[model samples]
Target: MANHNDRSGEIVLAEDKAVMAKAAEWLREGRGVALSTVTRTWGSSPRPPGSLMAMNDQGRFIGSVSGGCIEEELIDRYRQGELADTLPLSLGFGVDNQEAGRLGLPCGGRLQITVEHLNSVTSIDQLLNRIDHGELVARQVDLGNGEVRLLTGDGHPELSVSDQSLTKVFGSAWQLLLIGDGQLARYLARMARMLDYRVTICDPRETFTDPDPLPDVDYTRQMPDDAVRNIAARPRTAVVTLAHDPKQDDMALLEALESNAFYIGALGSTRSAAKRHDRLAKMGCSPQQLERIRGPAGVSIGSKRPPEIALSIMAEITATRNRTAGVAAT
Candidate 1:
């Protein structure tokens, strides 16, 4: 497992954010810097699909796109001043599919990256500030001409702004959808926030009435079903139901199970989980769908305490996400 403090190859916009921030500061200190982003990738590529790294003229570097496949060449470009143009340029790694095996990428993945020269105006300081303030921003970087524009939206790309062009969104890693307001939920929310997951807590009953206890979570009194219905789960979102009641957990699970959420889990015990499944079965959920419910939702580490259980659950969720990313890379 990579240390949380180590930023190498992290699937975080903040990692790149800090890199860009430091690069801008370096430029202020009279250092020229260039930033490279992996805008699109296909088949067996390393790193997340949209990872960014920056390099300064002094040969200092941060972040990564591949498992060291192109980092050396990028550093060389900076050293020799090969990339002086401000426009974005595309570079390919490995080989074509027919010759992929010989080049080392078994699946023969190719990546299209955009590298831009960073100056005072073209820097991402304002964009990074917005993301730090918990705002989901969409940045349209024209690959054809290398112009970048920032817009504030709910983190979804709109229709193509122009024909025959490329646009990308860069901010935050993913969102965490949590259902329940118990002490466990509070702990999980705090931990998830530290991991940079945007967390929303849904519980209409107001079981945990005091809002001050959970300042980091976005508290909502909407019913689980209604709340789940309100947000469209994406491939980057994780949904977890901590409320023990079937009435609360079932509806949320039903809605989440039908979505594209990367992780869908609920809290329960062996006997309790079996009963929960039986109730879902009686409620007309098919066996295949019932299997989608990850009950006793954590790795088997024998954690009985609330905080430890939350840790285990978060660990499971993160591990699931990493495994999914690795599969996508391959």
Candidate 2:
């Protein structure tokens, strides 16, 4: 299957990769292109502040800046030759309820859209290269003249827009490391990918782990503690022990709790979780470090099966990730 997200189903948070890649493709195929970004929004909006969409002269497109209507308007304008002359065009929609209704925007919603005539081919290639290398970066555009800059560093997944330019990040935003490769771990891996998380499964015990490995996830035969350390101990990463055994779970927990991973969770019953914590305490873990472990590791969803439990754990993980990023969970 074809995928636009850089190396689709392999990595996470290449949200703009699809749009950017499609724009590059159409350009290679000799088509006029216009790129748009939702710079600002107020009130109820379908897409968020940093949403992106790219369209070509043939009215073909990828990604979206709104639920649907905004793309239609931009495509219609492009087809009519009304967009090319005013290259770095700024337009507004849904200024009022009446306008919102006519444009199919949510009531009281307003979107500040900046559309640019595409020209920076080399910049797009370089941006994609950086993303492939896993460096957090942003592509900023000068709305006045279409100059694009690829900045290096801890780029946020959100966008910041001023009247003169728009800045947006593209790269891995979150990662999930599972300490086991059991059936539940498989379920969690798939579900986590659906949420755009780079997923990895680590289990040294081949006989103990699931025999069938998922193709998209990175499967490692490393010991649990080493696996925890192997991943970047950053705030955007999550470590969860789904092995349900002290041998595997505790090793991961010891390393994960000491690291700065945004979410650290363990799968088990309350009694089992308490025992795991005590076992770690005897192994020199401080109370505060032990306190950080989410035992019984999930929302209280009364989950009793593999998929349901995975869902609950992901819910807790998602909430933690959002909070760590200073974003409200919707």
Candidate 3:
């Protein structure tokens, strides 16, 4: 499940973000803090480029750059004042095969790390605020002085470093809008949340109820169409209809089709999908717009079980996300 750019599990990324937030909090409290980032990697490094780790003056740390292998050493260096300067230092690990083996790097894997001694609590607070409000921001750091600047970011590389400076982009967290509260929707919501997607379930029907409500997910009684419109559209947003009832699914699909959501899907059979397409067309949807709805809602995995179906759906969404990123990069 690991992505090419980072670890596979969304929970890991969530933890990394939490670490960044904590680091900012510590800085605001006037404590010395250092942020270590994986700037580059080669030959099977456990962490990918742009992975983050943060530590405070108290020697407490969060997140990871080499899983559990290199963190303690970094902390020890910081505590000894070897990294107390205001400038950023680029350090390398696992460059030697024997050292790599001793450090538990996989097969001589190497990582280029940038450690920044942060002194600007105001900048850190602003960056954290921007991220909390769903802004994609690029942080540019001067390697010589440790000065930082935050800029609005479009689609760009997440991390780029040169001899003089380092620049990294942070995007808003992904979100998922589910149009049903059925068993299948429950499984999908759980999976999506594990992937770091902010999940919201919308259903006006009183028939759907869960004894164990999901943590951090918003369950709304708003009608599907109204909910979709209220959420609006974003490039990282995804909308899915698992209600199987036309009255709910169709209205939601119509609104979602017009939004900026990157992925829109509905659950149904081939015949039902065709009928829904026709109905949408009759409602004035263009041919190209109609094609945006991914009927059957997943890759063909021949899944009959709820969890299996949920996996297929997430797989398709991941594929779509990767493809979109590729296009944006080009």
Candidate 4:
């Protein structure tokens, strides 16, 4: 496939989400490419560690590890074909403390980039194929000599890895679990679809109804608790209970807290939430697990309507997905 600029580089996250898929597609079409990832960062970094950027042999690139500070430089080097035989290289931009002041970004931040060559055996196509199957894979980068390696980590075996400068490889996919079939849940479900999350909604009441224009979401008419009983939760998964019924919300909350899901929240008022907490406590929930639930869900966006509240909820979920501290719901 010839290099094409899909304008995806303009988006900080679009590139991150699709780079692996795009790289895999290119390699499958007989094109060569390389990937670079920022595995670690310190103090006020532009992108967190694990941020990735990929480039085709023709110098077409997607994704960014910095806020446009280093892509142009990397592109120039890539187009000139300087990295083809460098034996996998880890390059650091921004000079040392004194020189950093001369180059800007002197705010005392560093960017470490690892460049790796792509080939048939190293086909990101295969890697992404595994990811599509829901497995977790890790890419390990040997910093001393730039030897890119791939290994299957514990848990999901269907995950894929593409970056070459990885010192450690871990696999995770964000999950968006909605515990209601109400209009608000439908709205949130649509937004979550755009965010590339696997969405599941559980509603026991047929009267609660199905959303007319639902996105590609998994729907279960089973009782919320029973619907979620078999699914194993992980840190990447988020469970939001919006079903107002205690039986639905309480059961899902209890099960979610017992699992590995990182963001567990419910939709209710302070008084209602307090009551729910007391109920859960009476049901034997510990204080620590109860603390994990964000009742009266969503950040304080001053939203009074369902759509606006949906936006607030999405914002909090996005922050949680990005590992950013969420503003408490007030």
Candidate 5:
């Protein structure tokens, strides 16, 4: 939850993965590690709820729960053994105007943080493995006894803490399915990867050659419709057709519309979009399905260049995803 400045939702999730992985590594090395999480925030706090930070007995740390002095105070307390007896400690900062200024909180911001001492490397390793394998898991920590357990999560609830326990949900990264192979597709794939989306490009044209093959992306020469069907649709999936050719684009769109993809888009001019819609209608697409497709693909940014157009598309996707995730506007 460190300031991401217009990045997509998965970027924050990726940061969470990194911080937890680092904590697991520190514990494996026989070092004492403490994990701190922001349980709640109020009024202009730099970090939001569920933000994480990890510290070692050697004063080494990774991640950020806040932008300023709050982390320093937590580290000092850990090193001084003030938190030794308390297996799980809940602390609040910036409760008053004076305290807010002292803790470097913006305005009269306040934060509730839960700190836990991590002593079992095996347990942390198991949790990290589950996440890496794309499982939706919930980690529950009992404040009274410092007991930790991992349970299958439903993947909808946000992180929450009660007087007795803290519950945090972890899931797989979001996915992007692009039905094209071109300069525009390349740019969009690169940007999407940086935003932490797992990108896959499907194009059946034998003439299509990847100009720059991204390491993380999956490229397939299979037919777009077949590929889309294989990928299926999930709530975290977004499908975009950029091939322009109706044979390919329409085929992919038809399959994508039948799935549960959260966003379905096609790139084209106004006339071209209308023509595509008419063709789909004749092909027996429902009115409800047609309504889900966003013609021209992106926000009206008046961008003519490939990179700018890609940025516009990603911006719109980010906005749509945030709205779906129930994130509040700053």
Candidate 6:
């Protein structure tokens, strides 16, 4: 396999939607490749367990495992074709004082990484296909033989590594729905994309126009309720209404409050939130459902600018997604 020179110094994210696809593509093109995953992390590791990266014989790679030093070491070894001959094997870094210092590992941090040599692209291609189609699948790699098993459905933890094998769940990208295309929405959409969310902006008003539109986010002119229904709300979806207009925001909230969406938020003040709740109650929303909508949405950051508001909103959404329970200060 010939080494490709494109993107010579770029560091790609394994968390992005493209890693598995890119891995499959590299294999199909006859490159000698290996997939590396952070199997376990102990104490403040840079990347968490389940983080993935793939390296080829040319030292070209995508994804990250640590604070660059680990990646460089792995790349150097792979460049010398050291990893391609192995059945799946585990490599540990930062076990002791000297090793931690040498590897630039954060103090007291250690990581266990598994590297799997690839000879066939079929499994990767299948994994990519299923996730792209919105299915949850688990990839199990036998530690002794490098054999891979792809299982559909859930019940597996995000990452599990036993003595015999390692299993990691792969799912469709998380989705974010914004009920407006205003400046606040634009900033939120941009930030959400950075977090690997498939963001969509829905605005039904024909009179509304964005002076600048961000790329890679979908736009729809469908009514907010219709948009929610069509998106098929799931546990990985979040809905935020930034339209400001009561009619538009309330319509989105009605459907969002009832759906499987993991997070639902709206922009407004405390008084405005109370008034909106009354409207929702008259509209037949139950108390429980009303509680799901985080109005005056976002942690109170005293944000007065559009960007800061967007940041707080995204932070709140992330907290909800991670199930970080607390008496919300906002």
RMSD of each: 7.1, 5.0, 5.3, 6.1, 5.2, 5.3
Q: Is candidate 1 or candidate 5 better by TM-score?
A: 5
Taking all chains together, the TM-score of candidate 1 against the true structure is 0.64
**How do the residues 136-208 of candidate 1 rate in per-residue lDDT, one tens digit apiece?**
6776667667777787645344222333344445565677888888789888989998887878988888445
- Of candidate 3, the 10-residue stretch with the lowest lDDT total is 2-11
Model 4 lDDT tens row, 159-264: 2223423443334556788887778988888888777777888777756665374757878787766666655355567889997888888889888888877688
What are the models' TM-scores? 0.64, 0.81, 0.77, 0.78, 0.82, 0.80
Candidate 6 off by > 4 Å: 1-18, 29-32, 75-87, 95-105, 131-136, 142-145, 153-165, 282-284, 324-330
Superposed model 2: Cα runs more than 4 Å off:
1-15, 42-44, 81-90, 95-109, 143-145, 153-157, 162-165, 278-292, 324-330
Instruction: Give the 10-residue window scoring lowest on summed lDDT in candidate 1.
Output: 1-10
User: Which residue pairs come into collision in candidate 2?
Assistant: none
Against the unseen true structure, what C-alpha lDDT does each candidate score? 0.71, 0.78, 0.80, 0.68, 0.81, 0.80
lDDT score at residue 7, model 4, on the 0-100 scale:
53
What TM-score, to 2 decimals, does candidate 2 have?
A: 0.81
TM-score of 5: 0.82
* Alpha-carbon deviation at 68 in model 1, angstroms: 12
Q: List the residue pairs that clash in candidate 1.
A: none
- Candidate 4 local Cα displacement, residue 243, angstroms: 1.0
The sequence of per-residue lDDT tens digits that candidate 6 reaches over residues 1-330 is: 122222434545556335566677788888888888887778878887778888777767877777555787888888877665679878998756676677666667788898888877888888878887888787888888888899964555567778888887788667899998888888999999988788999999899777777889899999999998777465578999888889999999998877878899988899999999999999999999999999989999886899999999999999887662111110
Q: Is candidate 3 or candidate 5 better by lDDT?
A: 5
